[model samples]
Target: MSFVDRLRELRLDAGVFRRATDRGANESAPSAFIRPRPIESRSSKEQSVGRRQSSNEFSGRRFFSSAAGSPVSRPAVSSPKKVYPTANNSSWTTEAKEPAGERQVIKVGTGVRPDDPPSSLCPKPRSPKLKVGITLMTRKPHRFDWWLRYHRNLGICHVFVHVEDTPELLPLLDSDEFAGFVTVTTGDDNSLDTHNPNSPDNYYTLMQRQEEQVRRSVVSARRMGIQWLFHIDDDELLHLTEPFSRLVRELGSDVTCITFVNIEATPKSLNAECVFEEIDTFSQHLMLAYRNGKSAGRVSVADWHGPHRFTGRYCVVPVERACILHFESCTYEQWRNKFIKHKEMGEAKKNDIPFPFYRDSVTLFQEDPSGGKNEQRWKAFYQERKIEHFEQLHEDEKIRIRLTSCPKQMIDGASGSFCKWRNA
Candidate 1:
């Protein structure tokens, strides 16, 4: 007989089946109390046969009775190890026990298997939509409020400002007005020692400090998860033909940075108090190697020559759709202060360099027969020169000027004297 049949015969002989049936009918009686018939009542032959069969079943090879009533050996069954997904759902790991009692680990994530690739577990990275930041190095706290609002409105994610000799603005930096959006870094008093005679005429030390400031801003922006950074001056504003985010996305992955051409914005009349109110027209001549800023993250800037140049391994966008509205000379007073600041910074002595605006301004001041204090003549000269510059523009330059326009709301409300200009 088969092994199952033999086991059934043994149970019947022991009266275990009869006892189990009786216990089931008497539901009140506990199953544990059921007893097998006394083995003494059975013959010795039957008892010896049962012991031999039980010993054979438990031996090294589990046995089963075949069709011919011969014992057959079968392999032992093994329990399967369970696998679980990780929190990110990217991979899975399972632990299995070995025969030697050591634990074996198995990785079975989406991409971990031989047939799977990294793309199976990890999705293709999408281009960042709105991770751009702006960094400005300025000492003019008066324009900070308006400048901050302008960039914030443009959907810039972060702004880093390096304040030079502007301690009073520190309170605004700490205020909740710009809680997480704006960060301010201050330059030491020694930064103003550009006029020291020991320093080179080109003020290499000052330029180095400015470069360091830009590096810090870039680092901070990267920490904040910013994907692109633009380094602009306080007096300049980036003019975008479309949404900045869309512009960045369309640039594609290959382009690491974009350099925008600069066009000087001249005021029609300096009668207005605010520069934004007075300046309505931009120059037609694009500054070829003038002040330029970049718009990409993770790029290493080895050297910062000026607002227009940097040394690094990055591809520049070929189109000139992005341009900087450079308010180089806003008002007579502002220009005078800027000229003096530039002179002290050793910019006036850099004749070998091609900074047209600086060179022209300094030359005008030096050649002035009235010892540079003739305000009316300075204004007239500036206006005449601006007209001449505008007339020299090519057709393409004219198109750039036509495409650029300042948003009135940028300098409106509490951030600026919008009403004051409106009432005037």
Candidate 2:
């Protein structure tokens, strides 16, 4: 390239730059490039006008300034922030209503939480102040004292006994433990007829009447400051290492009902004089247990009442914190005799009891004085029957087996001599 040509190009570029700079410095544009005009010897009238316009614009617009008493302008109208609510919060569910055509304030925090079912649908959890009612139907008067002492040991304050319909047994009902007895008689809603169900009509009537009575019992318990009403029979007991109150506390509100280990009563020896102590509460209380060789079985001896057990159908609690002690073959000698006589009454005289069947069936009958042999026979028969019954039930449904011959569970456990799951 020639030097003359290069020189001409440079001059042209310089002229263009000078022209651009002149336009910016003219001070007639909407806004000037430089700020704070210098104090010249003489200022143009146009420059003064432009500077005044720029200052007015700056004052009218919004910009943060720390200067005191400065005319602060507000921001221009713009869209609000968008918020998306999540499932962990309730802000979106209970949103505030907004005016028509205006932007709604959709919160971006957690969303709506699900509502739990009503207490009526699901009963509240068990409480420690539960009032338990026990009803035992026994023909023998001597057996009451044993059960009374046993229940006392079990931490029960109230016990209701229902002795069989016998005039001789009425006198003992005056005792403190037996005083709470609800002696169901023919006059009391015709309890005897209810037990002797000939047809479905009879069964229904009996069931309805019994359930009504049970409801009354529950009401009474509630009035006595019992938050939970437990219904149990004579042979049934609640076995818990911790107090009933603790069980309720640990289970919390999730547990509506709890099931316990159903321990069946099986005879340890054939001796009719074999007195079952506290250790027998589980093993020697039921007929199946006697036949099953110190085995345990489930019985519906105890249940809870409140909102939990008040469905159209009985709802068994899902948790296993509580168990029902099912006294399967724990009937007294007189009761066993009475049962045998009643079942065979159709073939025999109404008043004339079947002495042979009664005598053979009841090992612990007052008159059966054969030391251990009679009891042994009863135990053998019971064990055979228990084995048969167990075979009928699924293996998973079988009761836990424990030998009563082992040192008494109560004494051993109390003395720290018992081991978990020990065979002996």
lDDT of candidates 1 onward, in order: 0.47, 0.35
Location of the lowest summed lDDT over 10 successive residues in candidate 1: 50-59
Sequence-dependent TM-score of model 2: 0.42
User: What is the per-residue lDDT of model 1 for residues 1-424, given as tens digits with 9 covering 90 to 100?
Assistant: 9999999899887798777765465443211101112223213322322111110011122121323222223344463222222223223223323332311221112112232245557554543455667777676533666666666765566887777756888777788878688877666645334333233343345565666666777777667777667777777776654344433443334434555545466555544455654555554233322333333343343334444444442323211234566766566555655454444334335564444555566666666635445577777766665444455543323322332122323211111111111100
Which pairs clash inside model 1? Answer: 292-307, 292-308
- Evaluated against the true structure, the overall lDDT of model 2 is 0.35
TM-scores of all candidate predictions against the true structure: 0.53, 0.42
lDDT of 2 by residue, 304-412 (tens): 2321133111112111223444544433342343333333223323222222323234333333434265566444554454333333332222233222222222211
Summed backbone clashes in each candidate are 2, 24
- Tell how far residue 323 is off in model 2, in angstroms: 3.3
